[model samples]
Target: MINMGVSFKIPNEYGNHLSDILEPLPFNYYQWLINNDEIHIVHDNEFTNQFLFDEDKIISGEKLYEKSKNNTYYMVFVTLRAFLKDGTIKSVSKYKEFTESDCQIILAVYDCSYVIFWCKNSQLVSKMYMYALSKGYEDIKYITEEELIKNKYYIE
Candidate 1:
């Protein structure tokens, strides 16, 4: 397994505020999203996986649009379906077209497949739970700090 040794610093205000509104999720990616400003949102697209990694880090969707050259606007919420494996640590996907300029690389490890959403707006993180529920996603909850410290290998 590759150890990236990345540590995330989630602002106390952001974490505390998000927890109150959004259901606590157990997925590591969700925890990472709460802490980090930019991420690669990946999902299946027919025969291959499609990835959308932010070109630049921004605090909100408005900032993202202002900074983007294309002015592309992403929805406030999105879903990702990925196949994760233990001992497999890859910062960039072989099949996906991502580079250092595209996003801040993150590391993850898991023993089973999981589905989660990645968002940019901290305030809208909780709203995703309702969207997921409407879309039929089951058992959506937030991951506690204790659980994150115990199970997650990537500290940031």
Candidate 2:
């Protein structure tokens, strides 16, 4: 069974250099994902007005892991699908940048601070919450499907 994921206000303090949660979380908090999942960059600020926004790009986990780990940059949203033990990647929507869909993982950030993550896998959310708590970001909050629809973080 799946549960509604969680949200938190990522600390945006001076000297924090919080470029985006994707950066810190990818390396420090959720590194395991790189090896286990195929990453899809749903949308990004740097890719504004580019095909990356319009087309689905299924990037290999190893490739992304090599490039993004420990780096500080901004990513608007990303969806992840696991590479199963049998070595086949889980299928996902051709495009789910907007309107929630069931993917293995969904990480979305808005205003460079507020984040909402809903994953089919609840353990991932639990670990993410733990990461936030460990970093003194204890404001992780529950979000309703209604709030998600209203927030429209994916919409400009």
Candidate 3:
């Protein structure tokens, strides 16, 4: 079963670059997404006007279509966790980014078991990743585009 989480917008300035997570990337991040073959184009549009206030971050319609048409700037991140039948906790955090109006940054966390998704555009996601790594999440694995397309998890 896949647990979903809320999608959040984050500023580019806050998180450590994806490059920091995995270096010698096969093409820059943007290029990697655009070139990927299996990504299912489910919802692509301008997410600009969906917000009534800064606190209410929602993607507007115009930008949505623009995303579908261009297919260039959007990026996504995902993480998956596996658990033992005996009640051991296993989790992974995957993250990504896309261009949004009034918001240049994005962040998200998906807790599958509780069906909880929390997202905030603050620099917190990147900070949290860094913190986790420092705390010894050394086995953290970066997903490739092929893997992302095969397991396209969206927030419904």
Candidate 4:
């Protein structure tokens, strides 16, 4: 497995308050985001919510919560699902159209912000919990349902 170093940030509008989450990792991307305008909120929006979540199926929120609850770490998972067309990683998929010849990399990213807050707040994190609550659909993911499932998994 290739551990692609996270030398990038998710843009400021995605919220720059990552200290609560990225305190452990030597986050080089945070500074990169601060300096570059190309990696702005709108860009992150297209790259993250639109490209990543919509194109690739990533599990976030509750699923992520359960995955690393004991560990204090936050990460945005990015999957580049691109294959060679003629002789490169740039292949045109049926889903999208492309005329370029460069290596085509289908990127899928997931921003896991909940893990950080869970560590910082511990239990007295009403504010953080509120944020997690807002991330899900109230009717689909009710407290009672969560209790029954005893599992934290969300796909979007």
TM-score, model 1 to reference: 0.27
| Candidate 4, RMSD to the unseen true structure | 16.2
Candidate 4 regions off by >4 Å?
1-15, 20-109, 112-123, 130-149, 154-156
Least well predicted 10-residue stretch by lDDT in candidate 3: 28-37
Tens-digit lDDT track of model 2 for 137-156: 64787654455555533322
**What is candidate 1's lDDT per residue for 1-156, written digit by digit as tens?**
222122222222111112212233333322122232222232231212222334432123333222322322222222221212222222333212212213222222122112333322333344554545554544555433343334542222
Which residue runs does candidate 1 get wrong by more than 4 Å?
A: 1-113, 117-122, 153-156
Better of 2 and 3 by TM-score: 2
- The most accurate candidate by lDDT is 2
> lDDT tens string, model 4, 1-156?
211111222332343333333323222211110110121222423443322123212332332223233322323442222223333333232221322433222222345322211111123233334443444312211122222133232212
TM-score of 2: 0.48
Task: Say which prediction, candidate 2 or candidate 3, comes out ahead on lDDT.
Answer: 2
After superposition on all C-alphas, the RMSD of every candidate to the true structure, in Å, is 14.6, 8.4, 16.9, 16.2
Q: Model 3: how far is 55 from its true place, Å?
A: 4.2
Cα displacement (Å) at residue 112, model 4 = 7.0
Clash numbers, per candidate: 7, 0, 24, 5
Q: Give the poorly placed runs of model 2, Cα more than 4 Å off.
A: 13-56, 74-102, 144-156
What is the Å distance of residue 14 in model 1 from its true position?
34
> Per-candidate TM vs. native?
0.27, 0.48, 0.23, 0.20
**lDDT of each structure?**
0.29, 0.44, 0.27, 0.27
